[model samples]
Target: MLKKELPLKHIKINYDPIIDTPLEIIAQYPDLYEQKIAENGIDTIIYDNDISDNVSFYNITYALNKDCMMFMNLPLEVARFSISNMTDYIIQLLEKSYYVQFLCDPYWVSNYVSYQKEHHEHPMLIYGFDTVNKYFLAQDYFDYKQKTKQLVSFKDIDASYYNSSFSQLPDEYQLLNACVLHCSKIVNTKAKEINCDLIKQSLINFLNCYSYTKVETEGIYYGIQFFDILINRYHNDSDYVSL
Candidate 1:
């Protein structure tokens, strides 16, 4: 049996729960984390909102390319496609240096709050594999237990991932996200430096009330402007305002 391990760290992003798992997972990579803090750190923020009144994020998404690796989120069925055995697929990914994220049924996962109690679906991140022990190193946030790094048996992961309900979940709820921290040896001998000029321009863009056009659709708000939107929404449509 082979064993492979990667960084599995999570930091609390108090501003937005929507991106907590993904962004915190991103923080585990050294180069990405430092660059993220240098520019897209908390002080520079963007708030994204939809007509449904859902407020998703309160910080900027530099989309710093995930170190130019891969990140894809698709419905479970779409994700599985030719792949079989969820646990095996996950180990395949981990062996290739990719961290896997999927909506795991915590009820089947030991050390989980709902383990053996109730079925609740939430994003679970798996970053390492111990084939000899039949366990995967995972990170998950549970309300009652507090967030922790856990060792989950392959049996539990398989059961949690292959649960029947996950297939029936709505498009937004059914997701399997995988990301890799791309690696390559540096050519230059000098120490790395943050792009101060780019950071400056980003601030200017935020201050000038620029909206991110890369959004999937029009009318999605971004940047400092969302503060006004948040205030108005809270006053006018408090019932719909959600984080």
Candidate 2:
């Protein structure tokens, strides 16, 4: 008989001290970091300060699934710090059952947190992502949202490079193409297990077909997929999964 997929149990967290520690030193002892999370309830820790924006925190979140606790310091709003670099760290340290909470605003950076709370999903957030922006551009609907403005807007140089990089990904690996039929079933079933609309939408988004005809809908669809993949990978890893 095939082995059954187990529920998530814990999450692993990695922090980039250089980037996350803040120049002022948030905690006297490194252990204090973990202690704080414990005070709030969390598990596992790693430390780093350099990463890439192309990387996604959801990757780490999914990898941990519901098996472990994960934590990290809030990403800095300063331009000297790299979002991509921070993203890389987030992706590497994800775990299951662990919440990757940011000690930041809820409105701009709280979508992941909101999704988790609304869904009782595997990954949870203690804080939210930052929403302060240094670059100026024509304001759009997304710009009106602090979180979106912070998370999505990029420096012109970074934006061009990222667009090119995304364009080069294999069609199968493209955000929309990552899911196979089997993965879709796994996600849908898991969403029910979690009893969350956010999780359900996330699963649906990941498995959606990429269609040029529905560009606007596809964007929303892709966003869900992005987070779903992050949660799924973090939660479903062998180290976190028990037989």
Candidate 3:
């Protein structure tokens, strides 16, 4: 197959581990995300993985709920290509200039350098692949290291794919927890350059939708009011009073 590729888009916000995968995938389409944010006054957040158990991200931050257009946490099927064998499907996505994110075991994908049979689920954005050469070009982000884009062998990818803990649990070769985003739907949103004002407003919006009752019992505090409380306490401390 002819090589298909797209430029990677770097994320702009302070990264949060809970939502990093979806943000990185969305970052690949900056124009679309920006346009939506400008016009709709919100980001169209979508998730394929069930993050309901992530109480902080889902309930407090509203990352998965606010401005959500659509979300499904079920297995996805493509009519043209089998999810079990994504080579053809991925190539087609590349041909159409779509970013394809795949879930794989880090151990096999990195040739066991990252770990030994750890089966940790990781997301990789595949941009281009050469069928004749039997390799694919992809990018990955790690918290402790700089982001990287590298070419990996098809055999290694296949091994990681089939060996993913998500797939092995069912004893079948499948794309586990696969999610694809279509941002074109909200592409017409007004584009506003990110600034301090926008950041403040986004925080306000987040606090408005979040229910204090749910997290208040858990001792999770946030927002400007909480900040004031912290500031007052700091000022009252004997250490600061002497200073």
Candidate 4:
């Protein structure tokens, strides 16, 4: 009998789940996350005009080992064929103090609204497993729209894993099917300090309807100005803005 689970002190579910797991893992190390989060929190990208535009405070870059915790890519193909027993592979990774995130078909995941109804694909993180109970501790947003952890059967996860089709995703998302989240080893001797100056400047820029980055960039938008941008965008939808 073997049991393994990692500590996740908190979960921030404001963004997509791919980025959520990294933030949840890093939150366990508050000493590292608190100060850094205050410094490099917000990011905005708008490469594609119609889509791919995003504005977020908890960007993945800060959550990765560079800021608080760490994560490494695990190609789903490796887990698919390389391991004779997928459950054992997941348990071994957990035993080593690593959390695993898998992009799976939500239809096979019982808690999801799409469960057993649709084959929509999404990400789920496995933080612990109980061999005795035949379930893995996984995290996801229920229909309630909050971060919730549930005990999922090993068989269901296996089905979800096999049913997922990553090929339909964009090329940039290729091989990004799974992740191994771990903590940093280096000790921080320096005292934690909030970057009040940076935060103040960001607030100023946001209030002024200016880009926080201060440099001129195309398409990328952020801060209070985004509201105006959205208003103007919606206003163009009809002869006049509707509500």
Best by lDDT: 4
For model 2, the stretches where C-alpha displacement exceeds 4 angstroms are 1-84, 95-99, 110-243
lDDT of each residue in 1-243, candidate 1, tens digit only = 388876532211112333433334234234544454324332322212233121121243223232221224322332333435777877766665555665566676776766778655566666678989898877667555465677889988766645535444345433222222111111122322323344345444534442222334355444444434434443443222011
| Candidate 1: 10-residue stretch with minimal lDDT | 179-188
lDDT of 3 by residue, 64-176 (tens): 22222122211233222124565665665666655555655666665334645444555666777888887778766533265567887787767665554443323222222
Error of 4 at 126 (Å): 1.4
Give the deviation of candidate 1 from the true structure as CA RMSD.
13.9
What are the C-alpha RMSDs, in order, of all predicted structures? 13.9, 21.5, 13.8, 14.6
Name model 4 segments beyond 4 Å from true. Answer: 10-18, 21-81, 166-243
Q: Show model 3 residue runs off by greater than 4 Å.
A: 9-19, 23-82, 142-144, 167-243
Of the two candidates 2 and 4, the one with more favorable lDDT, higher being better, is 4
**For model 2, the run of ten residues with the poorest summed lDDT:** 177-186
Q: Flag the better candidate by TM-score, 1 or 2.
A: 1
Model 3 per-residue lDDT at 158: 70
Model 3 TM-score on a 0 to 1 scale? 0.47
Which candidate do you rate higher for lDDT, 1 or 3? 1
Our tally of clashes for model 2 stands at 48
- Can you give the TM-score per candidate against the true fold? 0.47, 0.17, 0.47, 0.46
